[model samples]
Target: MSLLKVRDLSIHFQSRQGILEAVRGISFDLERGQTLGVVGESGCGKSITNLAIMGLLSDNGQVHASEVTFEGLDLLKLREKQWQKIRGKEMAMIFQDPMSALNPSFTVGYQLEETLKIHEPQLTKVDREVRCLELLKQVGIPAPESRLSSYAHELSGGMSQRVMIAMAIACKPKLLIADEPTTALDVTIQDQILRLLKELQDAYNMAMIFVTHDLGVVAKVSDNIQVMYAGEIVESAPTRELIERPQHPYTRGLLRSLPGAKETAFRAPLTSIPGIVPALNARPLGCQFHPRCDFASEKCQHQPILTELRDEASTHLLRCHHPQEEVL
Candidate 1:
């Protein structure tokens, strides 16, 4: 059985103007011991999608799905009490900004133990402390013992992220959701954190959903990649395949903005996809990405549903009216 399966999952926010469909019908599966990167521009609903899966979306948001199953249980149907047992135990999320994600007043140790206290209540106080120390060490935080007593304010941004990672993995969750885990850190620290997460995933045989805006970071860690746009998945394939042979114009546009394409040797100006993502409540009549697409035509005004193509090693999915015949 797949470790996680999500099908036709959609989210909408109720507002005075109208309902804003933040996530359109989308689906994917995650196998055990694999990394799936969700990459998109800011405000493209990458974080909100995971938030819905984790049952963290605000009350104003409405989620509906044919199936959002994790280990055979439909997450869409789970209540808060049931989710309490799953969140932080079977699954955990590492937020983008650790300093804001963590509690300001609590010591790091207390926050770390809360995961165990809720899920592994049988563990004794000393055992919890021992496990917490091990987790800190596992994430490569120096002076683990001393740092346990420190507050979030005391640690640097990178250190705070390590603490967050430790807390997320304390229970050895089967699934890990990392939402821009290295967002604010320096380049050196960013590389270290990515390396650490990759090591941890391999050691634990964990399935991870890594969300980020940078293709560079996704390249470093993901085995598979999903490119999202305007609350929908525009392209998905094995990382190498997607990089070597992107089928969607949007995916091609994103790749064009990457660092290597900007070099003088390429000599070509780095071109970005024109226009902004459409507003959710005011979505375009056809393809949501039509206004910004280089190859859009009158037919593109009607949204093209996701279509799957089988490749030698993996399936590639794309949502586009003109995947093969774009003049540009």
Candidate 2:
């Protein structure tokens, strides 16, 4: 059975200006031991979608869905108190920035212990300490015992992230939501962390929802990919197929804009999609991505629902009026 199932999920915020639909009816599923990567630009609702799934969106945010189930349980109907029990024990999240996510005052050990105490309160103090040390070592932190006493600021960026991973997996969660866990790190560190997470996922047989704006990072880790643009999934396919045969104009634009093999800035001109993602209040009528889409025609003046790629496997889906033309 799928570990996670989110169908027709949408998220909106009550703002002073007006209601802003940050995430519009985007849905996907993750099987046990599988990773689904959500790739999009900043503000494209990737994080918002996952936040809604975790029941962590802010007070002003509201969620609506036909169904949001985890292992056959209806997650959308869960109360905050009930969600508390499920959060770390059944599903855990690793925030984008460990420095900000970890408390400044508490030692790393204390934070790790908090998760353990809440979920596995049966663990005695000494047992908790032993498990905590093992978690640190599992995430590749050397001298794990000494590091447990260290504060968040005392550890380097990479080390802090490792600590965060350790905390997320402390309960051996069935599902993990890692929201750009590799952000702000150098390329070398980023690679190491991705591989580490993959290793851990295999060892635990955990399903992961990996969120990021970087396509290269997504390509490296994801089994399947969902391409988001303007708050909706524009395209989705198995990883290899998505990379090799992207259908939507928005998806193509994103791939073309990625840095080439050099991985350095500028020699040839960089390709970028024109027009920024529309603000929630200013979202275009008809197709949300129409204004920025190169193949947009009068047909695009009407909205299109997500549909299977023409003549392709049923699993490959896109939301576009025309899928045959090359994306500008």
Candidate 3:
């Protein structure tokens, strides 16, 4: 059975104007010990989708889902108190900004100790501290014992991010939702963090939802890839298949835009899909990506539902009125 099953999930924000649909009935699954990369440009609802799954959306945000099942339970129906028990125990989240997520006043050790207190309250103080140090060490932090006493501001960006990862994995949660965890780190540090995550995933046998805007990052970490646009999944496929033969125009554009090591002068200019993502308050009716999709047809104005684009058992799915052959 899939570790997580998200089906027909919709999220809307109640505003003065009206409802702003942020996620429009998207569906996907994450099997045990697999990483599902949710990729998109900024404001494309990648983060929101993870947040919704984690039940971390703002108070004004309302989720309407047929089901968000994790371990045979419907997460969407869980009460706040009920979900709290599951949040850091059965599942955990790694926010994008570790600095913001970690308390400015508390030491890293204290923050992690607090998480332990909440989830594993039965553990004695000494046991909790020992576990915290072990977690820090597992994440490759040197002098883990001393690092615990350091404040959030005292640690470098990379160290703080590692600490955050440690805290998320402290409970050995079966599922981890990482929201652009490496977005703010330098390229070198980013690789280290990605490697650390993969290591942890393997060691813990955990399933993960990796939310990222970088296709390169997606390629590095994902088992399966879901390319979202505006507020819906535009395409999905096994990682290699998606990268080699993207079925949606948006997905193709994302791959083409990735920076390469080729000679800059001879390389084609990175192509971007034109037009801003539609405002949530005034999202496009038919195809959310139509205004920017080069292959959009009149039929797109009627909203192209997601469908398998070919006769073969491609596994890849796309939402497009006019699909194109793979670009060389």
Task: Give candidate 1 misplaced runs (Cα > 4 Å).
Answer: 262-268, 310-312, 324-328
The 10-residue segment with the lowest total lDDT in model 3:
258-267
Instruction: Score every model by TM-score.
Output: 0.96, 0.96, 0.95
Give the CA lDDT, 0 to 100, for residue 127 in model 1: 98
Off by over 4 Å in 2: 261-266, 325-328
- 1-328 per-residue lDDT for model 1 (tens digits): 9999999989999999888888998899999999999999887889999999899999999998899999998898888999999999999999889889889999999999998899999999999999999999999999999999999999999999999999999999999999999988899999999999999999999999999998989988999999999899999989998887887999988886665753436556667777787877778888888888878999998889898874445788989888842322
Which tens-of-lDDT digit does each residue in 1-328 have in candidate 2? 6788889999989999889889998878789999999998899999999888899989999999998999999998899999999999899999888788899999999999999999998999999999999999999999998999999999988999999999999999999999999987889999889999999999999999999988889999999999998789989999998887888888887777877746546687778899888888888888888898777899898888998766766489889888854423
Displacement of the residue 255 alpha carbon in candidate 1, Å? 0.7
lDDT of each: 0.90, 0.89, 0.88
Order the candidate numbers by lDDT, best to worst. Answer: 1, 2, 3
Better of 1 and 2 by lDDT: 1
* Model 3 lDDT per residue over 1-328, tens place: 7889988889888889898888897988889899999998788888888888888888998998888999888897889999899998899999888888889998999999988999998999999999999999999999998998999989988999999999999999999999999998999999999999999999999999999888889899999999998889999989998887777888887777667825435656877668787888888779988888888778889988888766756578888877767553
In model 1, the Cα lDDT at residue 54 comes to 93
Stretches > 4 Å off in candidate 3: 261-267, 309-314
The positional error of residue 286 in candidate 1, measured at the CA in angstroms, is 1.3
